[model samples]
Target: MDLPVGHIVTVLEEMGIFEDDSEPPFEHWLVGRLEGLAPGIRSEAERWTRVLRDGGPRSLPRREGTVWLSLNQVCLALLEWSNRYDHLREVTRDDVLAHVKTLHGHQRRDQPVALRSLFTWAKRQGVIFRNLTSRIKVGQNEYAVLQPLLPEQVERSVAAALTPAARLVLAAVRAARVAQIAVLVLDDVDLGNRRLIIAGRARPLDDLTLKLLADRLPTGDAGGRAPRTSTTPTRPAVPATTGSARRCKDRTPPLERLRVDRQLEETLTHGPDPLHLAEVFGLDEKTAMRYADSARALLEQDAESGFSRDTRQGGNE
Candidate 1:
């Protein structure tokens, strides 16, 4: 009748006929012709025939990498996923949540971090189907089928792995890659002009944050310390400063924009120093200072028009 593709592939492999070139002679053909094989076996035979006809290493053999997951968790995920979506052609969000629940076991009481790791592992293994509704909603609550690391999560992870100074160096390197900053060099940052010439390579990134980080890069040999190079030259820089402005402009009602603008005003009126803001926003101090300057300028305008106090007094005459 029918057979699972895995079992058929196994049988064919054992017989050394998975590839047509590896197929035996007339006797093999006679056996197959006389005793019609299952659909899975026939399908594999057709595939082997095409591979032999084309004959150019149709597929590269799978390689084993050192990365491993616990055998127990993997099996659990697989079983749960397959069992949930057997009738359907593809897995859905419910399938994923079901699988994650099983993988988490009693850990449901404590949100499971391993859920992402397990899904990534399954994707790498090519066992669970991909592009199967990466999002699913139940009742009023919605959950991503496979949520990746958030911007804050990435920053936290990177920060925990590196020192405060190293964090600064890494931000510049990433800024260069993402075209947020042109080049990160040992010299002064070119803000208004937007360019830098480091080591040998040159690039063009139009990011205010990178422009500022470039300014913070250490210069000269006078300090008596060896010059250190940025280590992370290819990480992605999340949109931080201009994101709010763009969102504000694009929003329909513009209330979001006003809210963002108000928050900006509050930060300027009473907030941490520029250096701390730079670190918090993953920006260079120079850029942070520029933002501070802009904030102070806005405050001045507000005071000059009496908008600052008037707004605080509920626009009273």
Candidate 2:
């Protein structure tokens, strides 16, 4: 028994976790803005752990962020399903199919991927004879719909301080992706020569984009050639003592993930490969595909507008 049910129940009860049992865990997690997860879910201590840890060759692949976040959702679903059906061993294909169908379409793709890995492992352990997850289908990649705003309009929407616009502009104009843009330091920008060097390759920059970067970028050198090596730590500021926890919450906004509109970022992210943008930006493949599609749509719209302008000018002549 990986779980000590009494301790788990105590913590959840203290946190006022799920007074209503009607809601799905996914919706509850998002709606209640759950910042913490049960130790069983966070650690390798769930009932699924045996196969997950010891299924050597058939082990599920690990992923980060939204992809791996699917695990918590899956664990919650399994717990609920087991309770309703009397045990995990009693679950069938219909139970999984019915549960999966309730998911938002995008999650229907991602979460099923998580569950399929688990179910496959379970089948090898004689929990299920066949991989019942085989027939579940998810929708394909979708493009971000272009907003009615122009490039400048979209750019202005971002905080001048955060510089998402500058990030987007440089990536788009240089035929680069977000990872390349994010790694860029003052040394990468050659304002005097109108060039941006990335990984020893000199990419020519237009005056406007260069000016945008110049205004926002903090230079390390008097000659603007020194590299900036400083990086913000990934962890949030933790309270040092029990007394400071309230101070921490007061000083920082409680729900501050900075969820800015990425429409402009999507429109600007350009590359030949769909996965390239995703790899660069630490985004999922579906998001990367959408960004590429938005970029293409923007380019097509520009070309059409340019052609129309030419036609109107010729008619006037």
Candidate 3:
């Protein structure tokens, strides 16, 4: 039977291998595991493992299992690369660069970070004469650009939203994240004021959005206040609403795509100002800048297309 790491640790503790007072440190397990390696390499691995356990700038507060796995993988990779070298100190910058080149994707990016940390620590401890990875630079990973929902697609999605919940989700995603929408209660909506309190901010409610909320919510009391119940029966799950939207024959864009499309539309309308986007959409400066950049690119493409059309017409004349 495949036992979990917690179970294994418990078993070890029960067997008196670990003290009864506290859980065994991750380095202890890592040290035992590295016993098969050469004495020099094993000692180096142990030191690195201890460095991870002690928690510094290089170390993240990850789970013991994740740390153990990562440590083992890094050690194995180093071991494979260091086979020809007489000692860790003999491993040059070119050797480190060559090893890094052999990896791909996140591994290519992450391994260098680990190497830099390990070598920096080793140099500080006087274990190595020099930090081999000091000058080795790894570029940040490039993420795929998120495609916003096209105008026609957005229109089709809105038209296809048949249910009150579906319509509410479509409306809410224009100004709020799906997570915020999922937890919305009748208290968050102010139909009389035509506004919604989303993530502690008051957002203006359109007439259509107000109507959708009214249809979903229970009838108001004598004082004209909505019942205290949640907006949807599944108050904390937006999937049901999204699922309802997807029931249509046409492929409906996800709520996230709709939110992106909304942001892009706002950017285009307001002239792609990152500060304005940040304030309006509650986006960080970096994220707002990315949206602004995307909007600018779109505008430039439109201008180029228009210019080409005019040139073609002039040539025809």
- The TM-score leader among the candidates is 3
Among these predicted structures, which one has the highest lDDT? 3
Clashing pairs in 1: 179-205, 180-207
lDDT of 2 by residue, 1-317 (tens): 78867678788889988364567554444423323434333232233543343336655534334433655557656655645654445667898888887888677677787787767666776766788788788555454564333334334323232433433343233334433444555556665665666655665554334555566454545555424456443211111212222232222112111111232333343332556644443457766666566666755776787743233222211
Give per-residue lDDT, candidate 1, residue 129.
65
Lowest lDDT sum, 10 consecutive residues, model 1, at 63-72
TM-score of 2: 0.49
Pairs of residues clashing in candidate 3: none
- TM-score, cand. 1: 0.21
Lowest lDDT sum, 10 consecutive residues, model 3, at: 308-317
| Residue 45 in candidate 2, Cα distance off native in Å | 7.9
* Residue lDDT tens for model 1, 76-120: 443444443432225466665764454333344222333343344
TM-score of 3: 0.55
